[model samples]
Target chain A: MSMGRRLPVYLLLDTSGSMSGEPIEAVRQGIKALLSDLMSEPTARETVYLSVITFSSSAQQIVPLTELMSFQEPSLDANGSTAFGDALKVLEQCMDREVVKATSTTQKGDWKPLVFIMTDGQPTDSWESVADHIKQKKLGNVIACAAGPGADENMLKKVTELVVKLNSLQPEALKAFFKWVSDSIKTTSQSVAQVAADTPIGLPKPDPNNMIIVL
Target chain B: MNTEKATLKDGRTIEFVHDQPRSGTMKEVYFTPDRKSVVCFYKDPCAGSDANRLQRLQMILGAYNPTLPQSHGGAAQNDIEADYYRKLFCWPTGIVVQPRFGLVTPAYPSNFFFPTGPVWLKGEEKNGMWFIGPKNRKWFEKNQPSELGSLIQHFSLCLQIARAVARLHNAGLAHSDLSHNNVLIDPSKGMSIIIDIDSLVVEGLFPPDVLGTKGYIAPEVLSTIQLDLKDPKRKNPNARTDQHALAAFFYWYLLGRHPLDGRRIPPGNTAEEQDLLAFGSQAIFCEHPSDSSNRPEEKQYVPCSALGPLLYDLFIRAFVKSLHSPSDRPTALEWVRGFVKTWDLLIPCSNSSCLHKWFVFHNSTDIRCPFCGTRFKGTIPFLKLRAESRPGQWAMDGQLAVYNQLPIFKWHIYSRVFPSPETDRTRQAYCVFHEGKWFLVNEKLTSLTSPGGNRVPPGQAVELKDGAQIRFSQEHNGRIAEVQMIRS
Candidate 1:
C-alpha cells in the first residue's frame, strides 16, 4: 500500500516454562488488549505495523509484521526453556527481511523499529553473541522487561540499555506493564507522524512502586 | 511537592499543584490550584531576547481589549469581549518568576482537545493535529460521523481559523509556529482555538525562535536551511510564512491531503534529506495545475474541482500559482472571504450516505453529489445577488444555495461590513425553499423591498423569483441585491 512511513513494533515475548499458568494467560490477554488499544489510536493505526516473536525452547515467528487493521493476535503457549540467543537471531533476520532501508533513490525506508522483549527467567541458551550482533546493526530502540523474580536483569541489560524489572508476576502488574508498552508505542507513532523523526521518543515514567529500571 | 506559589510582575500570586505536571517539547505544564488555568515552565531558562519578547507580548495583550457599544457595554459586554478573545486564542494571561521562568494561560475546555482515554490515566488530551491526519480523519468520519459535521460547517471552521490568524496579524504579531499542532478545533460546533501564543513573532522585537512545523513551513524558509543561524540570508518564520501554513492547513482540512506530499519520493540517501526535498526547496503541489505526476489517486478523495470554481480558484492561487512566491500567496483575509463564499454556496446532498452531507453548488448542468455520486433529482435553486458598487454600476457580491431556513448574513446585504453578532444581528434574512418556489423572510429591523417598490417589513416574507431585485436596508447607500435564480 502507498502510505507514509511505517512504525514496525516487534513483541519478543518469552513463553518459557516459568511463564506457564497465570503469567502466560496474562501475556495472551495483555497482547490482545495492547493490539486493541493501539488500533484505537489513529496515528498508531496508520503508522504502527505489529509483529510477534515468541521464544521458548526455540524462537517462532508467530506473526509477521502487519498493519494493525489486519493484525490478528496469535495464540501463545508456554514451553521448554527461554532461548534468548535463538530469539535474537530470528529478530535480526526479521529486521533484515522486513524493514525497508533508505537508499539514494526513490524508495524511502520505514521508521526505526521498536522492539519490546518480556521474559520471566534466565535464557537457557547462550544469547550474548547474537545479542551483540544485533546491537552492532543498531536496529531501533529495544526495551527489555524482566518479568517476575527469576528473570535475569544483568543478562538482559547486555541486550538493551532500557531494561525494566517487574517485582512480582501478578496479573495486574503484567497488565500495567503491557499498558505502558502500548502507551509508549502510541507516543512514538505520534512523534514520527509529527516530524517524521527516527529518534527515540521520551518514554512515560514507569511505575516506581512495581517496575524499576535496571540500566 | 503538593503546591507551589509564584508571584506575577503585577503582584498577583498564583498557586500551582506539582502533583501532576505534563512535560511537552519545550516546557513543563502544571495546572493551577483552581484548575481553570495552566502554568508552563520552560525547561531551559529564557535567553535575554526571549525574556524581552515575552515582556513585549504582555504589553501587546494588555492593550488588546475590543471596544463595545455604550448602551450594551458594562461588565457584561466586557465579559463578552473577554470570552470572544479567549475563544480565539489561548493568550498568556500572566508571567511567572521565582523557581523558573513561566507563562500562565487559561486551561482549555475538556472538548478542546481529544481525550487520551486510558493512555494517560491522568486526563490529558492530544492536540488538533491528531484528528487532521488522513487515517485518523477517515476513522473519525466512519465511526464518529456526527462529530465531523457537514462540509459547510467545516468551511466555517476554516473561516474561524483564518479570522483568528487575521486578527493576530492585524495586531502586528505573527504566529510563527502556526500549524495543525498548535490549533485546536471542535468540528461539531465549528469552533477553533489557536494555542501557543507565547511563541508569537512580533516582527523586529521578537523574531521567530523556531523555524516551523515540518510540511507546513514555506518553501522559501526551507531553501534557507543550509544557511547558518546568524546568516543574513537565512529566512525566518514571519507573516508570509504564516500565510503559507494557513494555506497548507486549509488544503488539509478541506481535502484531507497534503498539498506538497505526493507519490514521487525525492531521491535522497536519508529520510531527512528526502523530507527536505519533498517539503522544502523542491516542494511541488500534488494537485499542481500543470503537473499530473502528483495528483491524488482517483476515488480516494473528493477532487478539488468539486469544491466549485470560486474556491478552486483560491486553492490554485494558494497551492499552484503562489507555491514559491510568498507575497503572491493569498492572505488570511482573502481565505476568510473565500471560505465565507464557499459556505454560502453549499447544498445538502440527497444521498443520506454521503460522507459530507453538503457539496458546493458548482452551478453545473448535471447536479450530482460529489461525495457519493448520487444525482440531485429536484430543481436546485441558486441565488446570485448583485449589489450596487458605484453610483450607476452593480457587481455580483454574493451567491447562495436556497435551502430551507438558510441564513443571509449582513455582509451579503451590506457592501461595507461583514456579519458578526457584535457587528450585526445574527442574520439579516432567511430563505425558505419549499415545493418548487422560494420565499425570503426579513429577520432584521431594516426594511426589505422588491423591485416593484413593495416593502416587506420585519416578520413578513416576500416571494423570490427569477431576476428578482431586493433592497435590503433604508440606510444610506443601502444594498440593492439582484437575485438570479438558476434551476439545475
Candidate 2:
C-alpha cells in the first residue's frame, strides 16, 4: 500500500455514570489541550483533523473531522450504563467513513487513521461483534486505553492495540495519557510532512521521570 | 459542538467540558500576549491568580532549540521536546499551543524570602511572563539529614541535582543563581528541576558576570567582582559559571553539605588547595571522598563508569578554575558532553539496558549503541523532506519517512509489508482482494481473546460490508496515472 501523507485521529472517550466527577472533567479538558497542540503545529494543523466520540448508555460523536482552530470543546455528562460495544461500532463506522474518504479521493500516502479509546469501567453490553472487526484492524489503527477506577484491563485488551494501567484512577493519569497521545499525534504528523515513507522516526518513549507505560 | 459522553467496546465513562480555553496560568505566573509572540515574565511567589499564572508558565517553557549554543539549528531538529506547560494547561481541555521563544532569570533575590524574584520565558504564542524564586532553606530544613554520615551516605540523590543544573546549561543559558533553593523537587519523581530562573543568563548574549548562590558559586565571582545582573554585558555567566555550580552541586549531591572551612565558605575560594581537595574527593561535609576503585562504592554510585571520569574531572576543573577569574572556567557546551557522557553516574537505573541508564543523545536517524550496535530508543529523523505535492498527491521522492506504527501482524497475514498466509484457529481470517475490494472474514472471538473487547471471535463465514469506496491511484512523480475500486 502506498504510504499516506496525513493522519486523521479520533479520540473516543467514555463518560458514563461512574466517570461523573473529576475523571470525566479531566478527559474533557485533556482533549481540548490535545487539539490545541495539534493546531499549533502549522504543518499538522493543515494536514490533520481531529474528532471526539463519547459513550455512555449509547455512543455519541461529539465532534466531527474539524481542523483545530475550528474545533470546539466537547461538553460531557456522566449518566447511565457503559455501553462499550455500541461505542466500538460507532468508532469503527466513523473510521470507515474517514478511510473511505481518503481512498475515494486521489489523496495518496495518507496514514491509516488513528482511534484512541479511553475508559474507566466495565461494559454493560457485549462487545463481541465490534471487537472481532477491530482485532482484525478492520478500520485502521485502533488503540484502546483504560484509565481511572474500575477499568477492565482484560476486556479493554480486546479493543486496544495496547493496554495501559493508570497508577491511579485520578485525573493525573488520564491527563498524562492524553498528553502522550497528543504528543504522539504531533510527532507523527511532523514526520510524515518531513520524511520519506521508509525512514526511521520513533515516538517518545515513556518518561520514567513522569508517567509509566503499561504493557 | 454540544459535549457528549461516550464509551468503548470495553465499558468505561468520562465527564468533561470540551474546548474552553484555560489560559489562566497554573497559579504562579503573569504574562502579556501580543501579536508577534507571547511574552511572559516570572516573578517571586504570588498569592492567588498570579500564582496560577506562574504555575502555568512553569508547565510551558521548554528547551529544544538547536541553535541555543551556536550549534547549528541541526540539533533542535532531533530533540522535539513538547512545550509541556502547554500540554499541562491544555490537559483536561486538550488545547495544545507551541512556544516559539524563551528567556530565564540568572540571579537570586537578595532577600530570598522577600515578596518576589522575577523570570521571563519568551515564546511564539505568548511572551515573557513573571516567575517565582525558590525557598531553599525551608526545603532543606525539612528534608536534609542533620548528621554528616547520613547526609554523605545518601549523597546519591545529588546526581539528580547536578543533572537539573546541566539541563539549564544544555538549554544554552547559565543558571546565574545556583542555590539549593533555586532548585525545585517533584517529591513524587524524587528528582529536581531548576526553578527561580529570573536571572538565567542566555548563552547567546553571554558570558555574563558570574551569578548564582554564594555557597554554590565559583570563587571567580567572589574573588573577582559580584555580577551586576542588570548589566547584560558581563562574561561571568558562561558555561564555566554553570560548571562551577555543577561540580559544587555534585559534592553536595553526594556529601549533603557545602565543602567549606566552616559554615562560612573559606574566603580563599578556588585559589585555596583545600577547596580543590574537597572537590577532587566529591565530598562536602564528610571526610571520605569518592573512591575511583572498589566495586560496591563504584557500582552504588552507578556501577557503569561511562560517566564517572567526566563528573570526577569536573570537580577538579571547578576546584582549580573557579579561583580568581571566570576566564579559566569550562563552557556549558563542554560540560554538556561531560555530564552527558557521565549521565548514568548521576541517575543510576535498576535496568542496565534502560534508556534512563544514561542520557542518550537524540535527533538521529539510526541509533546504533555507542558501544554495541543495539539501537537506542526515541531517535527522530533529521533529513528535511522536499515539500512537493501534485494537488492531492504529495510527491515525496527524495525524502525519508518513518513507519513508527508497528505493522499489523494477524493470524492469516503475518504483516502488511511482508505477508505470508497462515492461521491459528483463534486468529483465522481470510483476506479477499477480489474485484479490488479488501475485506477480513471474521469469526466470534472470546472475552479471553480480546483486549478490552477490542476484538471478536470469528463466527459464521460472512462477506463484510465496511461501508466505503476504495480508489487506489498509481502515480509517477506527482502524476496520478490510474485509479481503481472494483468492489465485488
Candidate 3:
C-alpha cells in the first residue's frame, strides 16, 4: 500500500574505448529514444524505473534506479580495460538495490521484471562469479541484447539466452540494433499491456541476421 | 537478504515467490528503490467467504485524497508517494496508520497478491515520471503482512493506477497527465488505480493544454500542446481529456506496452523511428479550412442517437471538426457511452485510440482517418488492407481480410486505405482463406466491423489457419487481384 510503484528497465552498456566514438553516441541516442518512446504511455511513465551501468575501465552505476521521466543518458566516455565481470556485478547489485528489497509489507510476490543488457567485448577481467549469478535467474531470458565489433559472442551468449552479433562496427548499426531493441520492447510491452499482469510471457525475439543470435 | 534466489522443488534450486497479500513470516524479500513492494509474511482472506474485503480494501485505499499532483507532467510521482505517506500516518479509525508509509505493512488484513500500490519519486524528464516494481516475491516467502488479506496472491508487485484514477473520477476528477508509465498493473489483483492525482479536474470542460505524455495525448488537446503550451492561457484541461485517454489506457492495460506501431526505422539504419502521428482532416491551425476537402459536407452532425453507438458522434467530432474546429468535439461522458458499448461488444484492439472500441464495417460508421484526419465520412462497404512490399515501394493492397498484428504474426498493410480527400483510391478485392471461403470487397470500402461486427465476419467465411497455407494474389491488370487459398 505504501510502497512505490515503478517499472525496472536495466541497460547493460559497454564502455570500451573502442566504443568511445559513434558507438557510444548511438547508444545514447537509442536510450533517449527509449525514454521518449515510453513517455507516451501513462503506465510506463509512473511505473517504468530505469537503471544504467557502463562497463569500461570498470562497471559504474552511471544512472542509479531512476524513472523514464527522470532518467538522463549516461555519457559513454571510453577508457581503461573492459571489465565485464565488474560490470555485471555492478549491474546485478544495482538491480538488487533498485528492484528488490526486504520489507515488513510484502507477504510475498514476484514482479516478472525485464532487463536489456548489451556489450561489445569479452570480459578482460574475471566474470565467472557474476556470470554464474546472472545465469541462474535465467538472466539469459530477460530480453538481453549483446553487440560490439570485438565482442565475444560466446561470452555474451552465456550472459543472455538470446544473443546477437552486430554485423558491422558502425555505431549506426549499434543504434539500429538498439532501435530494433526499442521496437521489440515496444511490441512486447504493448501486447502485455492488454492482459492483466502475471500472464506467462515468452521472452522477446528480435529479427536475426541484422543482429543475429550468437548464443 | 538473499534477494536473488527463488523457491523450487528439486536440486535445480528453482527460486520462486508466491505473491499473496496475507500476513505471515518468511525471509529476505527485495523491493525496488521506490519502495512500493516488499517480501514479508501475509494472510489469505480469499481462502474464505470474505469477498467484501477486496471492495473494502479498495475503499480503504480509496479513502485518501491528495492523489492530485502539485504540477503538470509525469515527474510528480512524489506527489503520489507523499500522499501515501501522509495518509498512512494521518488517516483514522479502521484506517489505522503506520510508520514510513504503513499501507503495505504486515499489521493489516490485506487482500493483495503483491505490494504494488505506492510508487516512490525517483527522477523526472521533460516527458513524465516513473516508479519501480518489486524485484521478486521470493523475499515474502518467509515473512508477510497481516492487515492485508490474500486475494490476488500470485500477481506481481506492480501498481494499476487506474483504480486510483477511477476513485478520483468517481470523486469528480480527471488525472491530467496519464501516460504509458503512470500505470502499473498488479495482474494478481485483477484491478487498477490512478496516480498523480493533484492535477485531476472534474468533468464537462476541456483542458487548455494536454497534460498526458505526447503520444498518449488526445486529438482535441493536440493543437494546444503542439501550439498553445507556450501561452499560459492556452492550457485547457478537463474531464474530457481523461475520457479521450481511456482508450490508450486500455491498450496499455492489455499489452504491457504502448499502442501505436509508430514508424519503423528506415531500412533498419537508425535508432529514431517516424516520430510523427498524423491527425486533423487537413493542416494544423493556420491552414485549417472552413470547407475542409476531407470534411464530408453531406454528413450532418446529428446529436448521438444513442450514446451506445460505437464511434458515431465522436467520429465526426474528432475527424470532422478535427481540422477546422477541434473545440467542437463531444464530451467525455458522451464518449464514455460509445466506449462502454465497445467494451460490451468484446472487440479488442491494440490501437491506442480504439483499443476495445469494436469498429464496424458499415457505410455510416464514423472514424478518425489516421492519414487525412477526418471524421463522419461514409465508410466503404467492402475494403481491407493487405501487406505487400516490392523492390521500390510498398502498398497496403486492399483485400477482404481482417489483418491483425499478432505477436508471432505481425503485419502492417502498406496503406490504411480509408476513404479519403481523405484520399480515396479504389479497387476490387477478395480475401481467400485456406478453408476456401472468398469475400470480395473494394480497396478502400467495406466496414468489416459493426455492432457485433467483431463476433462475426460479414463477408463470405474464409477460415485461414496459421502457416504457409495462406497466399494472396492480386488481379493481373491492376484490378483487385484474384485471391487464392491453397492448402499445402
Give the candidate number with the greatest DockQ. Answer: 1
Model 2 Cα shift for residue A90 (angstroms): 0.4
> Per-candidate TM-score, first chain only?
0.93, 0.85, 0.81
**Candidate 1 residues B123-174, lDDT tens each?**
4344454466766677666666666767877787788888888877876778
CA error at residue A35 for candidate 1, angstroms = 6.1
Instruction: Compose the digit string of candidate 2's lDDT tens values, residues A1-215.
Output: 01123467888888889888887888777887777665544335445778888899999888886655577887889889988899888887777666434223233324556677878888898897788878774454566676755787778777654665665556677777877787667655533212222223234453243355456
lDDT of 2 at B365: 56
lDDT of 3 by residue, B1-488 (tens): 23323221112222213342222111223332234434221122221233343333333334434332335222124464545533222111121111111122221113222333222211221111121112222112223222111222101111223223433455565667665344323333333333323234444432322245544555445444334355753435554555445444443223222322211111211111111212211122111234333221123321222222354455445434542343454544444344432322221222534211322222233443221223423212233333445543334344332323111011112232322111223333333323333333223322222222232233333333232122222322121222333221
Give candidate 1's error at residue B371 in angstroms. 1.7
lDDT, model 2, position B307: 29
lDDT of model 3 at residue B367? 41
Q: Report, in order, each candidate's fnat.
A: 0.25, 0.00, 0.00
Ranking by TM-score: 1, 3, 2
For residues A1-215, what per-residue lDDT tens digits would candidate 1 score against the true structure? 12466879999999988899999999988988898777656556767999999999999889999988889889988989989999988999998899877662444577678899999998898989888876666676899999989988888878888899999889888988898899788766644233333334567667667788886
DockQ of 2: 0.01
